[model samples]
Structures are given as structure tokens and as C-alpha cells.
Target: MLWDWGYALEILPVLGQAAIITIEATLLGFAMAAVLGLVFAILRMLGPAVAWPVSMLIELVRSTPLLIQIFFLYFVLPKFGVTLDAFTAGVLALGLHYATYCAEVYRAGLENIPRGQWEASIALNLSLYTTFKDIILPQAIPPVVPPLGNYLVALFKETPLLSAIAVLELMQTAKILGSETFRYVEPITLVGALFLAMSLVSAALIRQVERALGRRFVR
Candidate 1:
């Protein structure tokens, strides 16, 4: 038969396990990206003294292919005695690769705050940390939620790339199923459907957050 219901049913449990790994990697990698990106943005905004090196680091990561980064992390780093397992290496690559993009998003958000806000903070003799934490990030982060949400979805999709390093994500599970059964349709289609469903759910959640933030921003 072209597609076997029995095979599909048998594979569901396997695929479900893989999906959990995918979700875990996505959430962890995105958390790293979010935090690291904020740090990068803050350092760049500190002054030209720090900005130039940070800017170059961001550019280097942005210019490289994520696959290369993954391979380097998984394969090459062990040569230097900095070894990581497949999942950790893949997650780190995803986090660091997307961090450059997240940094730009943060930079734009921080820049969007009016110059007057900075001047007022300085005039008040506020500490730099207080100005950023109390005055800056609150205003900057709200407007950037949609963009960051987009990145979250993007990073989730990118999890499949982890399979290159033997992470056994959804797509990898599907591929293994296909190889074992000598049939591709059921496993591949199931993987695609699961991805679509998750993407839609993420987009909906993002919209809800955006609306909530919009209300709060206006208030």
C-alpha cells in the first residue's frame, strides 16, 4: 500500500518522543538567545570602547552558516578539550546563531526609546543599571515582542537541523522511521503536520501576548 495506517499508528509513539526533544531544545535555545542578546545589546550601547569588539563578534556569528557552527561545536571543540554532546552542541549553536539576530532586535528596541529619556535619566543622576532596568527595558521590550516571537518560531523550525549532529529531533526520528520501514510518506507527513500545528499554536500565542502588551503599553 502507498501509505499504511498500521505503520503510522506504530510510529506515533516514537514521533511523540522526538517532538518532546524538539520542544525542549527550542525553549532552552531561545532562552539563551534572549538573555545573551540582551547582554550583547547592552554592551554595544555602553560606548565605542566596548561596542566595536561586540559588534564584530555579532557580525562574525551572523555571517557564518549555522550548520558550520553546529559542526564546529560538535566536532572541532572536542579537539580543544571543550567537548559537548550532540543535543547540547546543537542547542548552543542554535542559541548563538540566532543571538546575533536577537541582538539587532534589542538594539532597535533600545534605540527606539526617545533621546529625552536617556537625558532625563542622566540628569537625575541615576545609575546606568537603574536607567536600563527601570527606565529602558520596560519600554523597549514591549514593542519588540512580535519580532521576538517570530524568532521563537523560527528557532523552533531550526531544531530539525540538530539532527545533523545526531540529536534525534522530530525530523531525525521521521528519517529513521523511513529507513527502517523502507517507507517515507507516513513518517515524513506526520512530522510535517506536527510542525505545522506547533507553528500555528506558537503564532497564536504570540498574537495573544502582543495584544496583552499593547493594552498594557497604552495604559
Candidate 2:
């Protein structure tokens, strides 16, 4: 059969559970990536001494394949007296891998802030923290939200990689179902639909946020 609604319906609950896992990993990993990326960007902007090291680290991460990073975190870390469960390892690997991209996005946004703003902050005797918190980040972060949202969607799709370490996410569930029943159509199609639906929803939400930020900053 080209399609089987009954099997699709029957397998949905399992996939639903797996979908929750995928969502969890995406959210936690994206949060880590966002924060870590911001830190990386800030360090790079601090001075040449800090920038050089952080720049090289970001380059190293960006130069490497994410699958290798994931494998290293899951399979290799344990030998060094550091061990993580599949879910934790997956989250860390995803976060660290994408952080390089997020760092560049953040750097672009930061660089877009006018030099006059920095000089004005200094003239007003604003502390470095105050300058960044009150003036710079507020201006920088909003413009970058759309790109970060794109990363969120990309990270959601990347959750399939978690299955490599047995995190039991959506794609893994589909693979198991296909293997057991020897019918790939229903399970695979449903998984694809789920991903599509979630991606569209995420994009819509991102657009909404962008509009809200535009209105707020425009005021």
C-alpha cells in the first residue's frame, strides 16, 4: 500500500512521545547555543588578546563537522572521566556546534551598532556593563532575533542526529517503526509532516517577534 492511515494513526502516539523529546533537545540546545554564542561574541569584541583566542575557538568549531563533535562528546568524553547520558551529550554537542554560527550572527549584529553609540556611552560615563546592557545589547539583540529563530528551526531539524547516541527522538522512532513493520511510507511521511508543521509554526512565531521588536524599537 502506498499509504496506510491505520498504521499511521497507530504509530502516532509513539512518534508524539519522540516528538516531545526532539522539542526538548531543540529548546535546551538552542538556549545553550544562544547564551554561549553571545558570550563568544562579547569576548571577541573585548580586545585583541581576548578576540584572538575566542576567534580561533569559533573557527575551530565551525571548521569541524557536527557529527564528529557529537561522536566525540558521546563516545570519547567518557575516557577522560567525563560521562554524559545520550540526551545531555546530544544537547551539548548541538549547542556547541551551532554556537559558532550564532557567534557570527551576534558579531554581525554587534558590529552594526554605530561607533558613535559607544563613544557617546563613554562620554556619558556609563560603565562598560551599563553601556552594553542599556545601549548596545538592546540595539544589537533585536535585529538578530530573526536569524536566531532560523537557527532554532535548523536545530529542531538537527535533533535527528541525537538518534546516533540513542536519544529516541522522532526520526529514530520512525526508523524503528519502519524496521519492525517493513512499511516505510506511513511513518516516514508522518514524521516529515510533523517537522514541516513545527517549522512553519516556529517561523510564524519568529515573524511575530520581529514585528513586535520593530514596533518597540521604532517607538
Candidate 3:
């Protein structure tokens, strides 16, 4: 009665499906964050006119709570006739919220590059695109991979918040299972185990990436 193995087995498939949704949202959201972060970082480097506004936007996002942002996207946006489904709203919220932190990470990476590198590129008459693509990003991005990977793991954990908007991620699925069977222990414990397993796997992958980058850049 304390723990129903049979019930846990029965619910495993459903939870697995829901876990896939969580993973999908995390991946999609992190991809958006990575791209947007890089763009924001690059734009901020352009001039005071660009950097000031971009800095304010990044600060605004970082200062606010992600749950409120999620609610605004899912609940309030419908009032403006720009409606999004629960999953889309959740993924967007996650992406936008995390992108601010990622922007800071990228900015730090870019700033760490030596001033001489920029001068060298300019002296060589390299186009801005060529400078960044061939020289700057190759140096800036590798150093930031570990931090970006940390954000990826952090974003994955945040997927449980999607339940607030009925996105039916892992936590929401566990909650539904608990309510239906009146058995909270098995479902909730399993959800914790699943999250832990996934986090460890993600950490391992991040380390592998770091090693590979180290080798590539070591010359």
C-alpha cells in the first residue's frame, strides 16, 4: 500500500511520453537562447546607441521572475490577440528568460578577447563578418561553452514550471498520476529520479564538449 510497483509500472509509459515533451521544450528553448544571446552580444558591441538599449533589455529580462513572464506569455498575450498554445508559450518564456543570462555569458566571452585581436583584424582589412566568424567567435565561444552548458542544464530543470501553464511536462504528468491513483510517492519519486538521471547525462555531455573544444583550440 505504501508504494504500488504495479501502478508505477503502468504509469511509466505515460511519464516517458511527458518526459519527451520536457526534453523537446528544453532543447528548443536553449537553441533560441543561444542564437538570441549571440545576436544580442554582437549588437551590444556595435556602439553606445545599440549597446544602451540592448543592455537595458537584458537587465529587464534578468530582473523579472520567469514564472510571471510565462504567465504573461500564456495568459496575458491572448488578450492582445497574439495567442500561443501552452507549449509554445512555455518554450518562448523559457527561451526569452534564459537568453538574458546567456547574453551576459557571451558578453563576458567577447570582452575577454584581446583588444589587439580586433586591431589586427582591422589592420588586415577584414570585414566585420569575417572578423567575427573567422577570428573573434572562434576564440570567444570556446571559453563560454562550460557556462552555456550550465545554462542548458539549468533550463532543463526549469521545464517543470511549464506545468503552471498546463504544458504537461514531467512534473505535471507526475502530478496527474498522483491525483488519479491517490499515490503520490511512486510518481513523484520517479520524477525526481528521472530528472537526476538526465542531469547527470547532460553534465557528461558538457564535459565531453569541453574536452573536444580544448583539443581543437590547443594548437
Candidate 2 segments whose C-alpha is farther than 4 A from its true place = none
For model 1, what is the alpha-carbon lDDT of residue 153? Answer: 99
Task: Score candidate 3 by TM-score against the native.
Answer: 0.98
How well is each residue in 1-219 modelled by candidate 3, as lDDT tens digits?
788899889989999999999999999999999999999999999999999999998988899999999999999999999999999999999999888899989999999999999999999999999999999999999999999999999999999999999899999999988898788999999999999999999999999999999999888
- Candidate 3 — worst ten consecutive residues by lDDT sum? 1-10
Whole-model alpha-carbon lDDT for candidate 3: 0.95
Put down candidate 1 lDDT per residue, 1-219, tens digits, no spaces: 788999899999999999999999999999999999999999999899999999999999999899999999999999999999999999999999888899999999999999999999999999999999999999999999999999999999989889898899999999988998789999999999999999999999999999999999986
Model 3 collision count: 0
TM-scores of all predicted structures: 0.98, 0.97, 0.98
Candidate 2 overall Cα lDDT vs. reference?
A: 0.93
Model 3: how far residue 191 lies from native, Å: 0.7
Per-candidate total of colliding backbone pairs: 0, 0, 0
